[model samples]
Target: MRGRDEDVISGRIVEVEAYRGLEDGASHARFGRTQRNAVMFGPPGIAYVYLVYGMHHCLNVVTEVEGHPAALLVRAIEPIAGAEWMRAARIAWLASHAGNRSAVAIARGRDRLIAAPVTQLASGPGLICAAFGIDARDNGTDLCDPNSMLRLEPAPSEEPPPEIACGPRVSIGYAAEPWLSMPWRCWMKGSPALSRPGPKAAGTGGTDSARIEGTEPQ
Candidate 1:
């Protein structure tokens, strides 16, 4: 693992999705800044959390200029530490929703239900939150502070396979037209891990999903 990975994993952040900005129809800032979006006025590397669906919490990182609320939605992460504890937490939640032993088994015992390795653990925002044990309590945490648990790390120095590409973000149907097409989502070019098949070219439009693509796990 590298310093950057640790920065993102250990840091605290309540998951809150951002919908671009005022210029974009999908952004929360579309209506302009108020008390709730004050953080969006700050520089990059700040948390921008909000409640959605009147129930779930989503997380985002403020990026670009002070007023331009561009943010990367932390869709997932590869688990690093506290794997078992994270798994237990998720399992407990699943168990509670389970109505029978079979359902519990299916929920708790399935391979998908198991905690993935630290490297593969938090590949998505929701997975990242679960892997690092983040919850509503972590809302409004600072990510830029080195002392803070939540921080963004530069992607690994080594180059990933030339096949990486970018595409539209996944599961964001609510984001209107252009916002949906903005190529912000990244992933391995042709790796099987990609939920959707990537283009034939080299690193172009897919989201970057590798924790440390060219380097082996330490």
Candidate 2:
């Protein structure tokens, strides 16, 4: 059984629609579902790990039922317990990608960077995985199995409010307009973990409140 704290960190999942094989507007499987997409055809609650941009690892949960070929894209995650560990992992990753002196300085300064306290650590998919220490090693892991490192537990009962909203998934330009317009993303309305003040807040006069948005809550 997952401890309450562990469940708070791992149980909830964010779903996103990926393009299907060939005819898909935005899918790596567009050419045809192959060995790479075998997980998509597998039973629900299974991991569907895939490489994105030919580099970063992205995780997904096969949804619906067996042979349904649907999954939820784990775009981001809020670090619940192992924040220090997450920061260290992100720093190491950033440092690796950093070019020279300037990049290294930016990476070092990232320690002070404040991200959403909610599960969407960084808005993008790769950053979210890095922040939460998720990788290919977790591919095909059964979330339903208590012994599995990757398991989904119930989200905390004490979240902000009861209201849930949806918006288009981020950074999927290839998905086209209507696909981009689909409000599939969901997040808490005023949760600090899910929302943050804009960068301009620290600058010259502004009094905007925190606005939360993302895939539709399940």
**TM-score of each model, in listed order:** 0.64, 0.68
lDDT digits (tens) for residues 1-218 of candidate 2: 12344433332333333433334445554545578877776788887777777557787777756544666776545455655555566767766666556955884557544443434454456765666566777778887877676677666778644444445555778777555655555554333444332233335533322223433333
Candidate 1, residue 1: the lDDT equals: 18
**Candidate 1 Cα misplacement greater than 4 A, ranges:** 1-19, 95-112, 115-120, 155-163, 190-218
Candidate 1 C-alpha lDDT tens digits along 1-218: 11344343342221223345567656667678877777776788777766555434556778767766667676644444455655665555455545556864675464566744434444456555544555565556677776566555555478453443555567767777777766556654344333334454435633333222331111
- How high is the lDDT of residue 207 in model 1? 35
| Model 1: ten consecutive residues of lowest lDDT | 209-218
